[model samples]
Target: MTVQHEPDNWRKSSRSQNGSACVEVGSFGDGAAIRDTKDRAAGYFTADRDQWSAFVAAIKGGRFDA
Candidate 1:
């Protein structure tokens, strides 16, 4: 199901560099919303709770590290 969310209370990634693209996330009902730091007005992605948890776990496990 697609859920609409308004961005607020965003926390930025600590790994973000000063002059690089970044993202911020905010909590919503039973899920979370993500937005680009460079163009927040452009758009965002909302993930359900389970999906969000798994995504976080993958990050912790270095699944996307290069």
Candidate 2:
């Protein structure tokens, strides 16, 4: 998540290895854009910088423990 990127430079996570069932992330200004690798034309889900950072932080901190 520390990497900076230009628009449209989508990259799927390296941890993804289960067929095409994964997502891709790309930078959009200080924010980011995400889309399904299985369906590129399905549109995207976006998050601004703050939201993106918080989300990542939560994951790293295990705030989503089930």
Candidate 3:
């Protein structure tokens, strides 16, 4: 399915430095959109809100970090 990205509310990761190599995320109702900040027009990836939350939690818990 095609994802609709709202650039206006997209937030960059705090760990992003100098706006380089940064990803941006925006919430759209029950889902979230994620895309490369440097190429927003290229399109985005979308996930259910709950899945997004779980993904974030996993990242914070280092479940996906090597």
What's the lDDT for all of these models? 0.85, 0.85, 0.82
Instruction: After the best TM-score superposition of candidate 2, give how far the Cα of residue 4 lies from its true spot, in angstroms.
Output: 16
Worst 10 residues of 1 by lDDT: 2-11
Per-residue accuracy of model 3 over 1-66 as CA lDDT, tens digit each? 876546468888787798558888888768788898688779888888899999999999999888
Higher-ranked by TM-score: 1 or 2: 1
- After TM-score superposition, the amount by which residue 23's alpha carbon in candidate 3 deviates from its true location, in angstroms, is 0.7
Question: Clash number for every model?
Answer: 0, 0, 0
Q: Which candidate should be chosen as best, given TM-score against the real structure?
A: 1
Q: What pairs collide in candidate 1?
A: none
CA lDDT of 41 in candidate 2?
A: 83
The 10-residue segment of model 3 with minimum total lDDT is 1-10
TM-score of each: 0.80, 0.78, 0.76
lDDT of 1 by residue, 1-66 (tens): 976548568888787788648888998788898888889888788898999999999999999999
RMSD of 3: 3.2
List ranges where model 1 is wrong by over 4 Å.
1-5
* TM-score preference between candidates 2 and 3, better one: 2
| Off by more than 4 A, model 3 | 1-7
State the displacement of the C-alpha of residue 51, model 3, in Å, after optimal TM-score superposition.
0.9
